[model samples]
Target: MCQKNCRGDCDCESQPMGGGQRGTKCDVRILLVGEPGVGKTSLILSLVGEEFPEDVPPRAEEITIPADVTPEKVPTHIVDFSNQEQSAEELSEEILKSNVICIVYSVVDDDTIDRITDYWLPLIRRVLGEEHSTPVVLVGNKVDLVEYSSLELILPIMNQNQEVETCVECSAKTLKNISELFYYAQKAVLHPTGPLYVPHERELTDKCKQALTRVFRICDFNNDGALNDFELDRFQQKCFNTPLEPQALQDLKALVSRQLPEGVREKEGDPKQGGLTLAGFLFLHKLFIQRGRHETTWTILRKFGYDDSLYLSREYLFPKIRVPAGTTTELTEKGHNFLKMLFEKHDLDKDEALCPNELEQLFSVCPVVPWGPELIYTVATNERRFLTKSGYLAMWTLTAALDVTKVMEYFAYLGFMSVTNAESQLDAVTVTRDKQLDLQLKQTMRNVFHCRIIGPQGAGKTSFLQGFLGRTAQETDEIPRAHLPRYTISSVPVYSQEKFLVLHEIDIFSMHDVLTPPELHCDVVCLLYDASNSKSFEYIARIYKKYFEKSRVPVLVVASKCDRSPVKQDYSVQPEEFCNLHKLPPPQMFTTTPATAGEPAKVSRDIYIRLATMAAYPNLKRLVHVLQSRPSWIGEYTNQMMELPPEVTAWMKVGLGAAAVTVMGLLLMRTLKNANTAN
Candidate 1:
């Protein structure tokens, strides 16, 4: 639906790759900034060799840690800044490139600790700005020389500045907390606590609360607005990959109940409807951060597609799905089932249709409703104008057929990846074989077809497209032009199979019959003309001769406004005679006369079925006409004969060879006689 992450501060309509924002850097840039002789290079050397180096260089030569060796599974680049080896300009550049900064100090030297607050901290603030998001960790090295913990002295400094994440005292000689110092640096960049928690307020940040609220709502499978036992179990298993113990789950709920008695919803008259409220959910995350378990909250957020900034990552939302030329996309069976479950969860009235309120609730998790008002007219709906279950799936089918990428994005937004346990939305789509191959094989496995509605002005082109949705002429006319839908689609039944038929009106005539690549390409074309206008047939006749005269795509000549008084066309031949000379089927008739009160809604679906049939078997146009012309008994008998065993069908074809040969012989004789008459 969008090129950028929908919730982030980006132009959702159009954005380049990564969208001008940094997310999940390629490698971890841990820049150590401190005064001279603070053992910054010793820390880097100890991390690489697992022991303190006897003779360390003036500065550690930019060491690189492989992604496999790190805890976060991302390559780490430890950049050491030494005033002796690098200038201030180089240091500033390194600071700009760093993802996270570490301010190292010596535990034995109180002067170095004083320099941390006076010199190093001020330098980073001046370079990266006072309100920058780059996290800073306070490192106290040479703890072996001190008998007391330096963390107590550093605690006050960590609280005074919001940029300081935490303080850790380590010994390079004893290798104490050496690896953890760098691990915390990586964790700070991947899952920063500044955006998620407020230490002073002892609560979750506003942005964190909003992100968790969305996650909780998506996991509310029953739409009860609370996470019950079953929902909690599913959430735990999906986020942490382990089942939640029954007692453990109960104990957790009891803790919430004890803290905030009203958080338990049984007082609202139903125990099942009440479990962990949204406020209680936020409270639990705040508790996690308060208890020094912020990683737990970060884990859940990452599993739900949030990055360090708490925006849904682009990689998680728009996974690549390759669709080759001439191949169309359709929804797989699993995709339909997932949407079915979602619909049922929100259909509170149980009428098998989604009312306006129900639909709004269904899209609560999405940033915006992906569809518009045209959706109601684009698919089948109930008499009350609500979207039926069939209409819901049909709308999705149309979207997947036309804009497959859009459908995939909305799938991620709707929690399809998490709820269905699928890696990406590509699993929900099936790309059909090329249309050319389908024609060469004399069959197709596709269930969707696109038909272009090409015609002149005043030919009722818009009315014709909307008529396929069962809308009448008067109802469509009442709607303003701006609100009128440009396209309409619905499913049509062809014998035993169902195919989705899409009708898109083309305004090529508005440009004086100028055609583009889009206007001339489609699975089928509907050449519509007004039967009451003498000049209407001539316009379509010229179009057919100019464009589709020799193309393989199927064409259907439609005579609209049949209910009006008929008029002769200003053309060489009438519609039927023109079609017959070209070996095409006779022009089909169409009308959109208003219905009487209390009458059932009805429109001509057979026309759409014919279009889909032609698209399905593009090379069998003449055979399709023959089948349509045959009586019901003959068509039924043909179907039964085709259903026999392959061996039996082969023998049946052999038995009919003599009659076929006789028909061909008579056709040859008639052609020869006609040629003789012409001479």
Candidate 2:
């Protein structure tokens, strides 16, 4: 058979072709292209071979990769070219001749990254013919610059087209993702020998095959060529089919066995058993099978511990706080008990097993506010990559609330105490008993002004909280008889006290639901944005617009990720612009860098003092006026509510007495607490 020469510039003059390498058919060619400095040429050079160049030359070249399945050459051909000033018409002429094309951009360069589709694709389509399903790979180069990359855009754009074989981010300088690019591209272009591409995950593909292979080996016992009717029937009955449906099991076995590799007859000796051995079958399964959905199973394993074996025995299963590595994990006794309670309380249908969707619905009910996409995505993936530190802290707060007997009962006490408080006069913040916070700011956080911290993912919202607490604790170490507990929304203390409530990355929906009237409400809102990426700045709108009207309180705009650089909150816009843009007063900004080796860095006392000052502004006048009225005004409430019993009245008197003693201590009224109170 004769094949035409596709990329030929010359033709033979009526010459009869002889059987030789020169008369053979040409292989399909492909082109790789990108901006001038985007490593288009380097990728081809590495795949083929080239001599070392002392300095990079400003030129282009082409190389041929021969096809061979033998122990020698691999089948691949790549043409490397530059796209510095090429027009769409010229690039189209080049692309039409190639079977595949790759579009590359630096992931960190927002300008070039956006142009891949905006500038390149239309040109390619106009010149090369869109009717042809010519596979294209969107390559995001320089992924090592993760902090600088626009995740908001990258994730959405990559998700736009599922038909795209793979969206990859690689750093050419580090050679991080080069191999994966080649592997994925090769798989997308079909191979004549077999199916391609095995997923990197373990349980989804690898473990499933191991289980199947074990069953296959058992059916093929006695080193026979294949399983007979009795053996097949026994296997089906043992695995999934039941004994009551004997004929159905028998028929299903016959159907499955036929799909097995051919040439192996049901005899002791046969040539068809070449790849049918247990190990070979297992290998082939791993090499070819698609990974099944197993996020739920994996989540369970992660929460518990995977025991050494993927399969578990009933005995090794017990709840340990930490999951054991290298094993199929079993739920602990506590976990089992918790599951039983959950099923009994929530699942009215009473199905013995609950799937992932059901489990998510159950957890969602625990939140006072409805969960949003970000929180739902985190729950579904069962992996923590998408969750920020602040989000985790918010979850921790909720978990602590659940720790008490009832959720509403706990929040009622929390709600009541957060509303009222007395002022403290400590010059600085300090720590006592290693667990309590004893800063002057606690009085303001709980009693004076409402404060909230908000920010984008990884903008150091949690770290800022840690810094604030640590600094305040250090400042008031000299104060005797002072104890302030680190405050969380879930475990907020009752009684006439003040504390900073650190609510982390709150999902906007959840916050709104909780803050609705006739329920829990917040006094202030903090709007945080990331400094390194502009998209974080835009996200500030989504949070503020949702809750600003409901809050009717001051909103402080915090630009997080400030440690990447110094804080910059000064915008030229005036108050009208703020209203036009729906933004709060530009936040009082702060930046922080990591501590150096062997040096412990705490929050500066100056920042804490400033924060305390701002927080104390709202209630200082009211508190001072009430203090001026003194003993008469304070006792008015106690005297007016005459429905109280004598014992209850006595308890109230004791509480008032304690408050008076605390007030005297603050005012230096006496050297001690009456020296002998019982007397």
Candidate 3:
């Protein structure tokens, strides 16, 4: 196919000077995401040899040129952006257009793991729609700090989920991981057969513009090209200005006041320069803008023509000019005026601009606790909240402020926070009592214990619980007096500082629910089986396999109603044999008898003590005590037939139903309105 022979050196390095082809077709796009100050830009610089700034700024720019691999011969390009100033939608749009994704986490900080799972990963999935479209790599950046246990702990959690392609622990600063990270990202992009199609600027049409406009409306102030303190101040003020009672407002304000303030440590001379600079204005501006939100903000800034050195050279008007760390090369008087105008235009009445502390207060109302107060403060003072689980939780928790503590604590417990100490074996009177505790006995009621009761309708599962509570089942014989396990447990409300725990159901938890990232190893699991019903044993076995497959905990297999069948030789499988097969402790089999069964109730007392002794963690006990001490409002509404006039009752029902419907309708309308505005 060669028409003309290639000339000297001929640029014929193309195809060995034989064929007339330029090169093999290979293209790749990679996105950088990580926590702040993790050397993302430095690592990128080392790999690509492109000088990037420390400070981040709004707007997107290409930061790297195509590089060819020596051995693999894969052509690669990186598209780096920040989550600081853009919404998840906007960020997703950018990522969706890319071929490969790199999620960076600093091994020094355990918090980054949550950010990757709860925030960044979810957003990526939403954009990519399929996990395979863009291969993801969970990067443990800053390998120099890998000695920390938190880093060790973090890697396990990421590995447990098994979501990412591969995890690499490398140091961007030491250039330890620089080459490896590039290799991994390039590998992910090449895994798929087709090339990643990145659209040109024309793709962001009028629709995207409208979407961006609304995002700007929430972020921008005074119709300026950039964000400033005034816009941030207003946002914080609006959050605290709830339509609640005065006492509530005061309480809310007190909580808000505990947050970090804006510009507090921002203007302390730049790290490289000894003198203060007005570049602090640009720093603050970036901090107060959206693109300034994530760890990659600095990387994005380098692409946008700003760096830390320039920020240090500019002079400041205020003794403490607060600005984001990396944004402006130098802050001029003009930058100061642009920022000042935003304050004048939007926050004329407010004296204080949004600070880190105020932003924390503002975020407290979200339903899910944001990743941390630092991120929220950064968002409010600096105008961006990095998308992370913490950020999502913070926003959710703040907005929902209703019983958030309980949800957070439960999640923490599940994460495996030590809830209680193990109980010591003590001598007790009941013959059934032994030094060894049963599965249900070891985990105090304070811990999360799941028990399944199986038997015919006549079985004693409900009877056993009622008798343990010292309540007679006969007074209300038609309806069992046994207390059903509640979805959540709550302590009585008090304005006391003494720390306490609350238990709640997991079903109602919102996306923003602030979960405590602690271990929640289950303490006890009990499978109650009736000796009279052989079928009950099958059910118990199934429930055990389903629930306790992942949980490493003590299990008790209780053979209830031994009095009915008189402990047959093969009455259900042998407890010891069952335990041995499952690699668990031997079962605790006992006969349970109620007055109706014509058997002595003395055995019930012995079993109760055995169970209580095994499950005795202090925290779990306190939770039980707290639940037992609840106010009357939480009492079950048992009255079915009312003594009031039928007409009055009917009217009451109608009124309540109407009110509920109206509220629901209003909420729907408000949601629709907000959606339209955002669109």
Instruction: Give me the candidate number with maximum lDDT.
Output: 1
Instruction: Give one digit per residue, the lDDT tens place, for model 1 in 418-438.
Output: 799887788888899988777
> Candidate 3 lDDT, tens digit per residue, 219-260?
344433333334333333332322445454334333333332
- Please give the distance, in angstroms, between residue 465's alpha carbon in candidate 3 and its true position after superposition: 85
Sort by TM-score, top down from the best: 1, 2, 3
Please identify model 2 stretches exceeding 4 Å from their true place: 1-28, 46-54, 69-74, 84-87, 144-155, 191-679
lDDT of 2: 0.41
For model 2 the local lDDT of residue 47 reads 45
Residue 365 lDDT, candidate 2, scale 0-100:
21
2 or 3, which is superior by lDDT?
2
**For each predicted model, how many residue pairs clash, with residues at least 3 apart or on different chains?**
0, 17, 71
Worst 10 residues of 3 by lDDT: 421-430
Q: Of the candidates shown, which would achieve the greatest TM-score relative to the real structure?
A: 1
List the global CA lDDT of all models: 0.82, 0.41, 0.40
What's the CA RMSD for each of the models? 7.9, 27.5, 29.0
